[model samples]
Target: MDNWEEVHEKWTSFQNLDPSLKKELDHLAGDKKKLEDAFYKELTFGTGGLRGVLGPGINRMNIYTVRKAVNGLAQYLKENTVNVYDRGVAISYDSRYMSQEFALETAKVLGAYGIRSYVFDELHPTPALSFAVRNLGTAAGVMITASHNPPEYNGFKVYNEDGGQITPAEASEIITFIQQTENELTVPYLERSELDNKELLNWIGEEIDNAYLEELAQISRLDDDGIKREKDLPIVFTPLHGTALELVTKGLRQLNFTNVDVVKEQAAPDPEFSTVDSPNPEEHQAFTMAIEEGKKSNADVLIGTDPDADRLGVAAKDDAGKYRVLTGNQLGSLLLDYILSHSDKAILTNGRLIKTIVTSELGRKIAAKYGVETIDTLTGFKFIGEKIRQFDATGETFVFGYEESYGYLISSFARDKDAVQAAILACEMAYYWNKQGKTLHDALHDLFEKHGFYLEGMSSLTLKGKEGSEKIAAIMESIRKEPLAEIAGLKVLEVEDYLSGERTFPENGSVEKIKLPNENVVKYKLDNDCWVCLRPSGTEPKIKCYFGVCSSSNQESVETLESLKTEMENVMNQV
Candidate 1:
């Protein structure tokens, strides 16, 4: 036993832990830098799995690292499927703090390997556990959320069976069977009433929330005289206290949507969200109680979701009625111009629009003004749910997807970003811009009077532990050895660099190949239809950056997005 005497014999084998994790392993026993930051490594299930800060060592989130990451997803589904216990493992959880005892210790560590386990008896949203892992034909899926982190964080994620998240070569072969389960205190688990009496632990609630609110009412593009003229569109929502309060208020009262209000102190199920300081619905101070109940119910949209509702935040109200907030690239360019002015040009000639190369090229110029085609992943809505499962046999049709960090997806049912289908398409795009008398802030100022003033901005930077992971890998290796041919002065004419999968161009030294999936991200473009990226936030410690601009007005795209955010914080303060 070497490694610090095997972390003090695994912190004295927690002696039957859970007395508040044995008083946090006796307050980090002799505090060798807080027990080498909770046991120097071990919680690394990277490509979206196992988040931290819950407690008792080996880098937190306990129940023995959630049963060694559900026994490395039940030994990567008993060595890659063939009915590994009948292709099961759904599970879900979100109110945080030990999310239902780490989802029944991840269904008793996938019922001690004979697998099968549905779980979710309550607290749902993380896109209803990605539509309950493609409605339980599951070979994967687990989501004890850290979705919108805080309340001392918690996470686990993993998903696949095409319900997205869990790829990066199945999280590098399930972190090589969760680092060969050396000992999460001698692993093996089972006994959620003996895995629910060998039905292998079932449960599931409201038959998966009424088939995930009937696929969130086919993400409403509204009809029936536009839901009877936006059936009293007041809207206000708030689930900021976690788990989209009973399916975004019963999926907007099952679409009849009568002036909905909610936010009664963040509507309940709150795992210490205690009225926001960071339940992150992409921060507008987490919509301070849904913009003070949207200025006392005059409301015209004020949504807020976070804490596992799968990120969504809005605000709306403009035309001097006040409110504000938009940006997640202006509600993904007003929900892709209200789903391309109510779709059907034969489905906009086989539409598409997935985003995230740090989103907001004004949603790839409003999906090139309806002629659709706009892909660009690597930031994770599970790479736009693995590009809608690689264009699901290529007939093309996924009309909406977003991520400027307010995360959205209209309807591919659920492959992640779905604040209950973006709160019913953001209250049917704010009642189709208040029945044209306008306001989603006047359809984002008429899409910046037809796409020119496309401004966007983001910045992050936080540096936390291990010299902030060696200064976020020395600021992405000093921006790949200094490559900014002009940022605030605007003229970098291309650079891509998704960790050198290549793009270059820089005034003629041509290069191209970035056909995705390499990720460490960086981009540039500039010179008019301006741009800028620079990744690192694959689930925060921060580096972000983002910014974009188009100009030809809106105060020269907000002064060239504040001079490319003050030259990206002076290039992250000179790395």
Candidate 2:
């Protein structure tokens, strides 16, 4: 078992498997590097569940790995529930390679365990899956999407009955089960028709779609005058060859936006995503075509979504008449300000805003102005979803939630982030601004002025393969061993070591407890309102360094951030 020959033997035992499965394995046969990469480890099922390159290997995403995950989940459900089949699981998929097949395979596996499953009839957005889980009173849910990754990648996101990603404690239990059931080849899967005949499989479609849309409509605060006055404001949208085209466009039209233009080339779901280099909406390149079309049509805004429509990206015309893509922080700030400013007075009485710890502080400032309380969670939309559920269970009002990574949620109906809702709101906000003789950029600048210049940036250091993994681990260890007393000419006031669950204030020589769960992250707070945080990405092979800086002037903030980024890079490289 030391060399790849043992691995090949283990792989060859599946020769009698499905043709597609065998073909994928055959393509990687006898290639040492490919074999090692595919078998180096099992695809991890953590708090975020599994994500990997889509192919045939134990370490890769394939039928066997998926079945193993489902088997573990099935066992967990059976042990936790009194009525296994009655507490069904909701399943949905996006427009990625073999996403439908994976979704079906998952459903079939759950059916073999005598678990009822409700699956979307066609490709749908991730948020819809989250919503369906809670709406149907299911025990769990699964979404088959990579969420802005390239076509070569696919992922499985697991959710609990509350419509939130599995918490760390729950994920630990599932991971233990998956590890105990090591022989994935022995996992059971019934035929699709067999499950259908047994009444264990349900296909959900427009009925749920309409219900979800109706709930979304309830959150719309657009007035008749505003809609009428700005109905003709030109806007361009691109789904980046994903699942949101029809739903987002339909939502826009339903809200009385008559001049919204869809990028025809990327309007349809294409697995290859031929038009863009990567399907991620965060990158400027993903919106190249849409921006061009917007310019040609003299549109006021250009918006794009990734394959699953959970995250949204927007570009607005600046005072210089040039289009500038707004970062996730900027977009969230604008949305928060707009929603709070325009919301009914009744909802604001007990309203609360939730954001991840890494998100910009500008959101908190805006929320303060409106008497809205803001809470910080760990860096994931799941944490936001968890907060929403907690509030609902306790009868507290949920107002808005967002992460720094282009994800936002407005309504509790969809527990996860909803780009469909964000798209509709963005358009309405644009309309509101248009009627005020201003643009989104102008509005953002005014907000920046009100709340001192709050700037944020993120840098990622990518390390691939097994060696790269070791290197990243070493870097984190080094940082922990040699603590920083100062960074970017500012004295480090405190260091929050999430892994140790302790916060140390050097100035006061005192320590405090952080109530959050333990994680492999560290944050340093400077004398000024600037901070730096470092953590390994949960789903990708990269170490992310996040920066937040505040100053009286925009130029000063930008310069300070650049200096901090340069210093951090230099320190990391030396390690």
User: Best candidate per TM-score, number?
Assistant: 2
Q: Can you give the lDDT of residue 415 in candidate 1?
A: 86
- After superposition on all C-alphas, the RMSD of every candidate to the true structure, in Å, is 20.2, 1.7
Clashing residue pairs, candidate 2?
A: none
Supply candidate 2's per-residue lDDT for 292: 91
Name the lDDT of candidate 2. Answer: 0.88
Question: lDDT scores for all predictions?
Answer: 0.81, 0.88
Give per-residue CA lDDT, model 1, range 1-575, as digits (tens): 24754865666765765577777667667778777767777667788798878887777788988898888878988888778697788888888788999888888878887788888888888888888889878888888888887788898888888788887888899889888888786788886778778888888879888988887776787766655553788888888778888888888887788888888877777788887788887778888777787788788888888888888888887767888888787887788888888888888787888887767777777777778888887787787888888888887888888888888888886887887788777887787677778878877887788867787888878887667878988988988898878977888888898876999888989898988878888888888877888787766677778887877789978988998998788888787
Angstrom error of the Cα, residue 153, model 2: value is 0.7
Query: Candidate 2: TM-score?
Result: 0.97
**Candidate 2 minimal-lDDT segment of 10 residues:** 1-10
Q: Which stretches of candidate 2 lie over 4 Å from their true place?
A: 1-7, 224-230
